[model samples]
Target: MKTIQLFFLILIIVSCSSNKKISVNTSKQSLKNQQLIIDTDINTENIIVEEISANTEIRLKKDSITTVNSYITAPVFDSILKPKHDSFNKLLSMFVSKEGFVHYKDLKKRQLDLQKYIFYLGENLPTQNWTKSDILAFWINTYNALTIDLILRHYPVKSIKDIKNPWQQRHWKLGDKWYNLDEIEHQILRKMDEPRLHFAIVCASISCPKLLNEAYTAENLEQQLTNATQDFLSDSTKNSISKDKVELSKIFNWFNADFTKNGSLIDFLNLYSPIEISKTASKSFKDYNWDLNE
Candidate 1:
């Protein structure tokens, strides 16, 4: 009876061992098949590299395009425009002190710093009085400031014309519209009836009217602009008449259409000239000098 019981125990152990072996072999075969399936027809290396290349190329193109745009439309102001709380007072003081002359050399050196001050002016502009005169004054100041900034950026150019349109490839956000430099000069500034603006908006060239030492204020704006225009037009260095044609700054020729709105270029010049001159416009505008204002 003991021998029979031992034999039955050994038989049960052997059966369990056999079952374990079968189970292990089946699992190993399943694993091998799964691995084979995973390895088959999968070019993971190529797929991964292709995806990486595509992403890299797309990013590279996007950055390259924006870089080109930035060069064309360099930020006019390093920061947004803001208002100076004491802007009016400061401007008045400059005039009163007879120190309102903006020397081109000094301005060129402080170009970046002045941009910060302009940002302050922009921040405060929205809260200020929006009267027509005030609005006009702001526009005039902005135009002059930006124009000077442009000239300074390209200080060694021979003429303002040598400076390509900064807005040629990009748009600038102005008061209510996206203005290119062309539109700013021809559409806005030129439209204003205040002709004195012709002088106040200096182009950073010798022929252009002199830059004001201080900004214009509502209190003394009209007189300031008027004086600027008369001064520019009367200055023999900038505008003089000859027998056959008018020797005028290149700006007149560039935006001749603006002057033609109220009258022809000849007519506009005639209005300011003490001498009654012929209406024949000069066939040629003088070349501009873009050397450093200094």
Candidate 2:
């Protein structure tokens, strides 16, 4: 009976696949009107910004092929596809400052655009062929973007923590899964095993690592992660690092295990600290300020 069920499952999948005919018509004219984000490192061809109708199949050209029916159609199953972060990058380049502080007032003025891009993320997730780097980059962006949107929703506030359940509020649906910041951080991201990610996904706080102004692409993920880690360690305001003594942000203390996966916490700090850290250096964690990063 088990063998018969397995045979039927395979037969059903093959039959469903054989019945579907997919045809993609790229409108080069419409695509030409879509401005590529100037600073993004993603392939220009990866983004398709046409105003597609719900009846049309949305086929985006990224690392893999993804077919989506529409907002009304059931989301694609069994895969998490890479998202097009060009529009979100453009917005980030505009509203985020050199120091990583957000111009929340000005960003709030364009909340609709932000919401639209987020909805696109919901409709088109990363698929099987997307590199892990690409997928990780997508979620990092999603977490940051949603955090910003959350701040915008309750703008004019003092801190993100002031808003009720800032991290726990379920704001958007990505495919079939509804995600809050907590789930994305602990469940999806931390499990990826890249400790550098601790510095990339900000919580909209003053002490959090400055959100990268541009999107993370598969081509630039390694360097971006390295840059984020290095910048976070070297920032005097966040981590006061020296060869003999180190006073780090509370992030180091809270997520110590993450940074120590490969070796001791000092070993990880030495990788990015400008000066080599002594294993026996005095260590302390700074108070975390929850003030809004803006």
Query: Best by TM-score, which number?
Result: 2
lDDT of 2 at 98: 79
Clashes of each: 19, 6
Query: For model 2, how does the per-residue alpha-carbon lDDT over 112-155 read when each residue is reduced to its tens digit?
Result: 99999999988777766667898799889889889999999999
- Winning candidate number (lDDT): 2
Instruction: Tell me the lDDT of model 2 at 244.
Output: 88
Q: Supply the global lDDT for candidate 2.
A: 0.82
User: Model 2: number of clashes?
Assistant: 6
Q: lDDT score, residue 6, model 2?
A: 100
Q: Model 1 over residues 142-251: C-alpha lDDT tens digits? A: 76666656655766555566766653422234433444555666677677666556666665556666766667766678888777766766777667766566677777
Q: Candidate 1, residue 231: CA error in Å?
A: 1.6
